[model samples]
Target: MYLTFWGVRGSYPVPGAATVRYGGHTSCVELRSDRGKCLVIDAGTGLRGLGKKLAQEFRKPDGATYNLILSHVHWDHIQGLPFFEPAYIGDTKIVVHAPRAAAKELRQVIGGITRHEFFPVDLDAVPADFEFHEVVPGSAFEIDEFTVLPIGLNHPFGAVGYRVDADGSSMAYVSDTAPFDRMLHKQHFTAGIEEPSDEDREILKTMRANLVESLREVDTVIYDTHFTSEEYEQFPHWGHSTPEHALQICQEAGVRQLVLYHHAPAHDDDMMDRIAEKFGLLGKEANVVVCVAKEKMTLTMGEVTNPGIVA
Candidate 1:
């Protein structure tokens, strides 16, 4: 299996010199299997770049199948769907996997994106036949040779973190989530549930556990690590985590390899380098260091080709 990071920024789009090294585009990732089958996550501006690459790679692009797995419908996450050239190609097939009940409707999430007052042409003018798969928490499905599992996370607007298994290799993609703060919601809505829905709590706990579980004896774990201790201190409610939180989770879960993700747009190469220095120090102490993902970098998983510690 292969992993590619097209976009890493979070919350909103911030493109400038400060964010270029780690990248400024929002969440978009492309995964490929040995057989050349691909799965994409999020459709941020990076997808525009990725689409161009795909068009070149697959010369006979007609009759190609495209799968998009969405973390949430926040504009930064889906803003570039219209920009993805594949959507406009009449022969390509695209399937979008998105959350069901958390926040915005599917139409509201992707409607008129291409030609809103902001852009020029509408997606309706695009030529492809689009199919959407609306997935809620606890749902599981198969695409090509992989199994995809979605679990809910603690976000102001609900987001589904994913666990994917392919050819004995496992990777968990949880782009936007607060480490552990649903207690606030429990506190806020104390009057709503008749008796503190044990099932709901169990699900939340289970969702958190899944993060650790994916790391348990797994190959790769890509998690959202978009904040520093300082920023995290001020924005506790935002759905993001610190590198320390990521390291601790890796330690508890026993994940062999960790790739920090969902970088903040303001953290340029210098600041990101400092954060890596801190992470390396912690990893040296804890025996589990993680490397940040860069745009267009490829991570090969499975025993034969991948060597020790890809950093």
Candidate 2:
């Protein structure tokens, strides 16, 4: 199995010279089994490029089924769907697995991406057959050669992190979440310093515990590290995590490697380099390998044994 990062930026796309090295596209990743079965995570701006590649690879008349799992439907996470080329191919089938929203159905949430006012093509008019499945948090489900477990996350409008295990190899994707200590986000946003009730406090504790347990000893963890320690204090309720928060969880989970993902839009390549250096040293001391996720970076697993980067 292998994991490829097509996009790493958070909140929004930030294309420019400064962000060229690390990439400016937001939150898309591709995972493939050793046997070549494929599953995608998120549909951020990076999905446009990935879709183009997939269109060429699966151009046969019989077509192919592509499975995509999403953490949540913030604009940055789902904005690339309208441009996904395979959606224009008649024989292709796209299956999407995502967290169940509080008020909307899975299709309604996704189809909104292509609402006529927002895009030229309506989702219903797309050529490909799209299937939507609402994933229940804490439940395990299978997608082709992999087994996935969805764990609830602390994010606005709610979100869930995914742990994928296949062929004895495992990895987890946990992004767009806060540290779970200060805030308990729900379907709506909170305006001020709202403390959790006793009931909500217990829920937060269990949620954090569940996230750690789900990631236990995973080969790799691609996590949201969108804030610096200083920045986190300013916007604790913004639904993003600092590297420290991610490291703390990975340490408790006994994870082998921690890949810093969901880069803040304000962090350019130089800032990312500094983050990599600082966390690299911190991870070495913690006995976990740390890597910064970059666009086009690939991590091979399973038979590969060592999770080395491939050009």
Q: What lDDT score belongs to each candidate, Candidate 1 first?
A: 0.74, 0.90
RMSD of each: 4.3, 1.9
Off by over 4 Å in 1: 102-105, 182-206, 304-311
Listed in order, each prediction's TM-score against the native is: 0.86, 0.96
What's the number of clashes in each of the models? 0, 0
The CA lDDT at 83 in model 2 is 89
Model 2 quality (TM-score): 0.96
lDDT of 2 at 295: 99
lDDT of 1 at 62: 49
Flag regions of model 2 displaced more than 4 Å: 305-311
Cα distance off (Å), candidate 1, residue 186: 9.5
* Candidate 2 lDDT tens digits, 1-311: 78899999999999899999999999999998776678999999999999998998885867899999999999999999998999999898999999977768889989988888899898889999999999988889999989999989999888989999997899999987988888788777677546888888999999999999999999999999999999988888788899888999999999999999999999999999999999999999888889899999988665654334233
Highest TM-score: give the candidate number: 2
Model 1, range 233-285, lDDT digits (tens) per residue? 77766667888887787788777667888888778878888887778778778
Error of 1 at 153 (Å): 1.1
